[model samples]
Target: MKLNHSVTGQDQGLPIMLVHGLFGQGRNLGAIARRLSEQRRVILVDQRNHGDSPHDPDHSYAAMAGDLAEVIGAFGGRVDLAGHSMGGKAAMHLALTQPELIRKLAVMDIAPVAYAHSQNHLVDAMAAMDLQGVVRRSEADRRLSEHIHDTGLRAFLLQSLDLKSDPPRWRLNLPALRDWMDRTTGWPEGLPKGIFDGPALFMAGAESDYVDDAGEAAIREYFPQARLLRIKHAGHWMHADAPEAVAETLSAFMGGG
Candidate 1:
């Protein structure tokens, strides 16, 4: 499927693609995309079932990677890819399977291992809501807060809630995403090991346990040339917590420094 995307910057140099985390659209990373687009082209993609991308029942790593591959094939022969959370897993899979299409890989705050914790409640809360009667964003948010107490997370997730639509529908395919929570949260099985040996950067959040000492073993096994860096004072949402630092690190990693 042709994924929805935004392109910025010049046609010169190796282009960079920014893949947002779960429940995010391409425009969610507009700040980071604009910052990175200064010297080179930047492509912000909405993964399948998120944003304006097509919704499919298959929401696995392989399928997401295939979507990224298609984007790379269309935008450039190869691209420098950076992804956050769920998007990071897709980047890793694409880099591993189609190494030639990715010049460099950057995975932010997530490893290739399956996460023990599940975000099923987040999905379920979204899926449970019927936004047809919701007249205002605040009302929707207030109702959502009954299920999801976190204000910041509700704000982020609500970006995909199309309040401007006639009936105020959710831009995200909540049912399809909710159904594949297991595969979305965990790393896919049956993939070959350490297929990507190119320069790799794993930017972790100092405040997040997504990348721990226990996870390093698996990181090394999959990406032998990978280097890990921590964004101080940031959590899983490092870009939001430390936008400047994240952008700076991204620029340096992509050799724009």
Candidate 2:
């Protein structure tokens, strides 16, 4: 599947591709992408079934990784890759299966191991939302609030809701995401734990348990050269929680600083 992407900076050096997490569009990483684009080419892509990309039923990492491979191939077949959450898994899978396609890798707030948690509840909330006659975002927010209490998360999720359409609708494939929640939250079974011996950085949020000791060990097992860093005063959404710090850390790492 061809992803909808936006490029920044000049055609110099290996381009860096930024992939966003679940329910997020490529623009979610706009701050980091813009910062990194100052020195290198930055490509922000919307994975399949999200943003303006084509919607498909399969949301497996293998399929997501394959989609990313196609995008990377278009940009000289190699790239410095970074992904958050689900996107992180996709990037890791790509680096493991097609090591040559990645020059350097950075995974945000995630590990190579499968996670037990699922984001299906959020999908259900969105699916249950009443978009009928929802002429404004506040209406949708009010309806979603019945199920989701987090105001911030509700806003974030609403970013995918298009109010300009004839009837307000979500850009995300809610059905597919809900159906494939299990696969999305898991690592592919039976696949050999291949290694990616490239420069890899696993940036974890200091307040987030997404990358714990076990997660760090798993990361090193797959990427021996992986360096782990923890950003202060941040949670799972570390980039948004600490944009400058995350951007600086990524900039220095990608520049071999």
Each model's C-alpha lDDT?
Answer: 0.89, 0.91
Compute the lDDT of residue 44 as modeled in candidate 2. 96
Give the per-residue lDDT of model 1 (tens digit) for 9-32.
Answer: 877888999999889988888888
Per-residue lDDT of 194 in model 2 = 45
Error of 2 at 213 (Å): 1.6
Model 2: colliding residue pairs: none
Clash number by candidate, in order: 0, 0
**Candidates' RMSD to native:** 1.3, 1.4
